[model samples]
Target: MSGEREPVSREESSTVAAVQEEAEAVALVPELLISDLLRYGVLLSLSLVTLGTLVTFLRHPDYLVSSEALQRLTAPHPVPHGLRDVVVGAMAARGQSFVMAGLLVMMAVPVMRVGLSLLIFRQQRDTVYVAITTAVLALLGLSFLLGAAE
Candidate 1:
């Protein structure tokens, strides 16, 4: 037989192109998800903080107190222990609660990004990455548990 190749069929070429496109899209999912998570998290948190600040200024025009008084009022406090308390406090227009919620959301974004990574690694059957992601998740959980214990 001659060494020359036969002309490729259009259907076969189209199929190969489609498969390549799918592979490229699949490879981009994790990156896209991470970027979107970071973008949305920051945006949402900023919105919440801004809204809280506006509400505080509007509701309490005399909120501008002495530095010492402001420091005392904004002193570090433990997070609400229960969801109900947080939700109720936020609904009641508690500026601190809104700010706390925003901070919490900001913190959660990275954890969620890690979780998405773990899932993607698992789906791709990447054992090394899966193990690494799992360890990271474990450490994150441990930190939260230890912090809560304090």
Candidate 2:
């Protein structure tokens, strides 16, 4: 035989098969990790929020009245015509809009986290994902503080 060995057939190409499987396995790891993190984070966050909201309600249960309840209480069974406008106006201002907005953002933080997590998954980037995750958590906490103040 010549100094050079005989060329291998396609079936003998182990490097290509190993590389292909490694690539797929590598792609799967981050996606699985992200999904797990999001699920756990959401559960933990919701639990904490539920506890805090309950504690707050316990501390000041009077603020739990719905707008309709407030209206009904302010008016008799057959509300007086003149009083209807006043009741409506009062109901309109029942909740603090700014606080509500803050609360809404708080509620959306986990959702935003999911989106950012997916972005990270697609881009295979870590720095931005970690930074954004921290920011979302911080903002969510701030919103909770603002909401709790009301």
Candidate 3:
């Protein structure tokens, strides 16, 4: 057998291109998933916030008529501080609680995205990104801890 390269064939090249396209499509799936995650997360957060505001206005119509009611609501209170409180309050149809939960959900979206990216990178065997994403996750956790301490 002659030690020479074979001539490129249209069929072979097209097969190679098809394989590359398939790989690209596979890569896009994760990106699309992440995109959808962010989109839906934000949308859900917005919806919750809107619903909460509507409920608040409906329940406390005085807020619409009086600045005092708005001021009172804006005043800091420690009732719905914990996760359990937020969940219970939200379940009980409390507007403020729903707003709190919505804000929490809004804050959580990016963190969730990062966590998802880490998983994707890990699955893809991308060590660099995995490490970076891990570091970012750790930093986010640290921020939450520090903020809680404040």
TM-score top scorer? 3
lDDT scores for all predictions?
A: 0.82, 0.57, 0.89
Query: For residues 68-127, what per-residue lDDT tens digits would candidate 2 score against the true structure?
Result: 657755676742223344345335543222233334445665666566675664466567
Off by over 4 Å in 3: 1-21, 75-79
For candidate 1, what is the lDDT? Answer: 0.82
Model 1 over residues 61-144: C-alpha lDDT tens digits?
A: 667754665765678966686557767889998876787677778888899999988998999999999999999999999988
Native RMSD of candidate 1 (Å)? 4.8
Best by lDDT: 3
Task: Give, for candidate 2, the lowest lDDT window spanning 10 residues.
Answer: 94-103
Query: For each candidate, what TM-score against the reference?
Result: 0.77, 0.32, 0.78
Better candidate number, 1 or 2, judged by lDDT: 1
lDDT of candidate model 2 versus the reference: 0.57
Pairs of residues clashing in candidate 2: none
Q: Give the Cα-based TM-score of candidate 1 against the true structure.
A: 0.77
